[model samples]
Target chain A: MSVLEIKNISKSFGTLDVIKDISFSVEKGQVVSVIGPSGSGKSTLLRCATMLEKVDSGYIAYGDNIMVSNDAAGRAKYSDKATLNKIKLSTGLIFQNFNLFPHLSVLRNITEAPVCVLKKDKNEARQTALELLDKMGLSDKADSYPCQLSGGQQQRVSIARALALDPEILFFDEPTSALDPELTGEILKVIRTLAEDNMTMVIVTHEMAFARDVSDHVIFMDGGYIVEQGEPNEIINNPSSERMRTFLKRIIEK
Target chain B: MDYSELLKVTGILLQYLLPTLKIFGYTLAFSIPLGMVVAMLKMCRFKPVSWITNIYILIMRGTPLMLQIITIYYAIPMIQTGGSDFFGGLFSGFDTRSDTYQFTALLIAFVLNYAAYFAEIFRGGIEAIAKGQHEAAFTLGFTKTQTFFRIILPQVVKRVLPASSNEVITLVKDTSLANVIAYAEIFRKAKEQMVFYSSLAPLFIAGVFYFVMNAVLTVVFNFIEKKLDYYQ
Candidate 1:
């Protein structure tokens, strides 16, 4: 069964349609990478999928439940807070800016959601947070604040924070876009490990080589629509669309 | 003019200062939570609730606090019980023109006025937080209240501390305005000493007292700011 199904999803800000009739599905343990030029609405699509941006029309389903919709006025609304909470539990989001709570220590940052929101036992949340930090090779940095960590370390802690919630699918929005070239390896390594474990993920990324390497399915988007999609090898090796060819040529050359 | 007279005046001022400090303390004790409630009401998404709080804040902030004191002290009793006799009888036989009445009026006026200003400060602080933090908290499955208290309020307090400390210190000075109601606070005692002794020294001494109190408050606020230095 598909873990997430989005049908005819559309989003617009004022009158400018950022996403139009977008539809896709993710199976239980698939890694899908969305690649496109700037202004292609890839990030907006990811945000809409996560219910961060309300879609103007259509519906998002997780398992058998619809998570969002438009009312008579065409304003997007979630099904309900309770159902949104359940839907959010199944998905984790990794942001490009590494929006860690600066006031909290690394350990607290990871455990805050689990302890406060999930109502997990404090000791158990701390243990899980520490274990996730250890997985990110950041156990020693647990007591440090986000400001004390490098961009790579902070991003890794952000991932650990998401993982501490035990989400089934992770949505990464340009995870490496803000990293220095040298620092990108650490974050990519953690993502690569997750991909190897067959954790369902939908990633909007700019790293062409990383997309070509780790993605099971590659989606090319441009002008607020999916231009092309196929196996990573096919999309990278064969050009089906002239726009895709031009886009890939520019990325590959750069 | 002599040291003995100075001592007598200083001792008299000390007698009133304690009650003044008590009033200030009690007013703050009442106002902080009351202000927070007002701030919450002002921020409520519901239009009528927020609108009512907005008008309350506007009236409290827009009117002179001296008028509020007079209204609370004089007008409220006249309006409620029809005369000072009935109002005085209600207050354990204390006369409405007595020091106790003035003290109560001053306390209410200070609390209401500061509550309005603090509400505005709180509103600015709460609104200053990036919308992303709310989204982050929501996505983490935090309920709206949990997101506010755990994630949002702490950050808001950190941001508002400097401005709040300024207001708090200003509040200390503003307490001097209580003299209008005939409550014998520090400044009132100084004025009374001048009238009785024909000396300006007691007035200057009161300035010293205010300076010392504000200095102490400044130190306390600095310590608090230091504790919140995590963001830096």
Candidate 2:
């Protein structure tokens, strides 16, 4: 089943049509990566799918739930906040900036959603957080603050935080874009591990090689449009569109 | 210079300390929560609410606290009784002109003034929190209220502490304004005793009281800041 389905979604910020009538979906266990130049709206698309940014017009569904649909007035309307809470539970998001709560310790960051939102027992949450921290190789730093960690570690902790909620589909908005080149590998490795476990994910990224390596499908976007999309090997290895050909050539050379 | 005279000065200042602390405690008790409410109102999505709170903050911050205390304490009684004795007739036995009423008015003014400064400080702390924090918390399925109380408020308290510590220190000293209406707080009592007994020791004793109280508060606030220093 499609874990997430978005159709005919259109969004604009102050007359700039950042996302112009885009549509896509991610099925269960599928890994999709969206690659685009700056201002191409890949992050905006990921945000819209995750419900962080309201869609100006379209349909977005998660499993059996339709999160957003047009109202009688032809304006996009979302399910009530109560229902959104349920939809939000099924999705998790990772940002390029790592967005961890600076005031919270590493342990608290991972357990907060589980305990506060999921209403899980504190002990169980801590146990789950410990296991995730161990998985991220951050068990030793569990008591450390986000500000104290390197960019790489903070992003890993954020990934752990997202996983703690046990979302059906996780979204990454250029998760490695903010890190040093050396640190990007650490974050990408974490995402690759998730993919190996068959966790469904939609990632917006600029790291073309990482996308080709980890994603089941790769989409090339430019000027707020998906220029080409296919299996990672086919799309990255051979491109049909002139724009995709030049774009891939330029990034590969750089 | 004698021990008995020193002890005598200490006793008189100590007796007035309770009233001084009474005003300080009440002002903080009322102002802290009121300040939070006002900061929320000032930052709320509604236009009118922010506007009203903005004007209120402006007026309170713009004016001197002593002026506000005098206006509230002196002006209200005249306004209440000057009209028709309507209030006087209604509550025949009670006097709005009494020392008790003046202290009440002083408290009201102090709360209003301090709440404004605190509201600004709180607003600064809250706004300083990165937008990403809220998004992350909400994306975790935490409700807005949960995000605020659990995720946002604690961080804000940490950020606002140094600023609030200054406000708090100033509040201790500003409590002396209570004497403008002759509420007989420690400073006022010291001044009265200085003239009545023809000795300056009461003034020195009052200074000691202010210093000791402020010293205790500084240590408490520093302790709180250190506890929060676990994070950046």
Candidate 3:
């Protein structure tokens, strides 16, 4: 079964339509990269899919559990709270700003949801948290506060926090866009490792080479719709549309 | 300034510390939590709860606490009894026969008045948290209750510490106002000593008591502010 299915999703803020009739699905263990310029609805699409923002009209299903479906009257209807909670427990999202709880130490940030929300044993959660921190190359910084870490380090800790929940699918919304130019490499490398592990994931990003190297399928979005989608080599190296060509040229030239 | 007289004044003033500290302790124990509840009500989306709490806050803040003390201690009892047993019957079962009823009235006055100030401080702290924190907690599958107590309130306490400290020092001094109801806190004892001895030394010694109390609180609050300074 596909890990995620979003059908005919539409969203808007006031009069500005952010996402327009977008549909896509992520098969289990498949890596999909959403590449688009600013205001191309890449982040909005990710937000809607992750339930951060409600869609105006659509059906969203995660692993055969329908999260939201359009009713007979065409209004979005959400499932019961128990089902939604179950769905959320199986998904994780990493934000651009890192959004680490400022007052909590790094170890607490990673172990909090596991111990509190997932009801894992405290010592067991701490043990697993240490493992994830070691994977993120941040084991030494366990007790440090978020503000004490560099932007790159903080973003990596956020990734560990998301992964500590054992999510079935992960979403990254421009994870590296907020980092310094020199600091983006470490985050991209970490994401590459996750892809190597065959994690089912979707990433909205601006790094052309990183997307081409890490994703199984590439999606190019513009004006709230998919402009093109295909294997990474064909779409990244040989674009068929003028808009995709222009957008890719602008990123590749720089 | 006889040495023996000075020591005697200090000794007498120290003995009155219990009632003064009692007022401070009881009011803080009740008002801090009461203020939190009222602040939540004010912030809740219900129009009627917010409106009613607004009126309560406005009335409490708009008037002098001294007036409130007098009204609660004196006027309420009068209104409860003056219209004969028909009206006074409501307060018949009210525990007025105890010697501590007057002190309870004073406590009630302090709690209601100080709770209004604390509610605003708490509301400001609560609203100042960024929206991202709530979103992060929710997406992590935390219930609304867990999100608030675990993720939200610790940050609020950190932010509101300095303002809360100022109010706390003011409360140390505000405890003197309990003398209005003739409850005989430390200040009242000092006033009696002044009249009895025909000297202002008791009053000066009382000033020392207040200064010492305020200074001690300043140090404790500074320590707290430093402790919570681990966050931004």
Candidate 4:
């Protein structure tokens, strides 16, 4: 079963249509990577899927719970609060800059939402947070603030923060785009481990090799639309579209 | 320049310190929460609610605070004369000549005036938080209120401390503005002592009180700033 389903979604910012009637879904326990240039609206696509940006028109659902659907007027209408809250609980997002709460300890950064929003017991939340931190190789840094950690460690803690809520699906908007090449490897390795463990994810990323290696499916987007998508090996190695061919060549030469 | 006389004046001024402390303490206690409320109201998405709060902040910020004190003191009883039975009865029971009425008027004026200033400071602090923080909290299923109090407010308190400390120190000095309504705080006592002593020493002694209060405030704020230093 598809854990997330988005169909016929379009989004515009003022006069520019950032996402022009795009549609996609992430099946359960699958890793889907969205790879594209900066202006390709891949980030906007992730934003729309994660509900950070509203859709102009679309149908989005997690499992059987519909998050956004077209109303009678053919405009996008989101689900009621309870349904939205349910969808929110089932998903997590990691950002390019690792937007961790600097005011909180690394442990609190992971546990606060679960304790306060999920109403989880404090000790249980702490236990789950510590385990997630341990998995992220950040066990010793639990009491440290985000600012005190290296970029890779900060991103790891953010991942732990998302995982502590036990999201069925996670979204990454250029998770390693802000890190050094060396640091990028750590994040990619962590992501690869998540994929190996069968955690469903949709990552909007720029790292071509990492995308090909970690994703079960690769989506190449350009000019506000998905230009080509298929199995990573086929799509990355042999492209039928001229745009995809040059796009891959340009990335490779860089 | 009689040193002993200066000491005597300081002693006299010390006796009236309670009223000044009351003004400062009461204003801080009431205005801060009221300021947070006003800040929220001013930032409200509802057009009319925000519009009214904007006008309120404008009027409060635009006028002189001394004038506000005088206006509130005299204008309160005028509600009785507005000839609405319900409104008139609100102030009808209190003897307008009593010290309680004067103190109430002083508090009302101080609280409202400072609330407007604190509201602007808080608003700036709140707006300074990055958009990504809210997004992070939202994806975790935090309700808007939870996101604000838990995620946003703690960060805001850190950002606004320096600015808020400025307001708080100013509030300490501003308590003397109570004298405009004949509510005898330290500055008022100093002025009376100056006239009686026929000397400037009493007024200089009053300066010591303000200096000491602000010095203590500076230390407190620095300590708070340090406590929050665990985060960037």
Instruction: Give model 3 RMSD, 1 decimal.
Output: 2.2
TM-score of chain A of each: 0.96, 0.97, 0.98, 0.99
Better of 3 and 4 by DockQ: 4
Top DockQ prediction, candidate number: 4
Ten contiguous residues with the weakest lDDT in model 1 chain B: B90-99
Candidate 2, residue A30: Cα displacement in angstroms equals 0.9
Q: Where in model 2 is the C-alpha error above 4 Å?
A: B1-6, B82-99, B197-200
Name the 10 consecutive residues with the lowest summed lDDT in model 3 chain B.
B88-97
Error of 4 at A27 (Å): 2.0
TM-score top scorer: 4
Query: Mind giving the per-residue lDDT tens digits that candidate 1 earns over A1-254?
Result: 78888877888899899998888888888889999899999999989888888888877888866797667876666797777878998889998888888788999999999888788999999999888888899889989999988999999999998888888899999998899999999999999999988889999998888888998889999988988998998998896999999998898889
**DockQ of predicted candidate 3:** 0.68
Whole-model lDDT per candidate = 0.86, 0.89, 0.91, 0.91
lDDT of 1: 0.86
lDDT of 1 at A91: 87
- Name the regions of candidate 1 deviating beyond 4 angstroms: A69-80, B47-52, B81-100
Q: Is candidate 1 or candidate 4 better by lDDT?
A: 4
Write the residue-wise lDDT of candidate 3 on B91-128 in tens digits: 66556557988888899899999899999999999999
Q: Where is the poorest 10-residue window by lDDT in model 4 chain B?
A: B90-99
TM-score of each: 0.92, 0.94, 0.94, 0.96
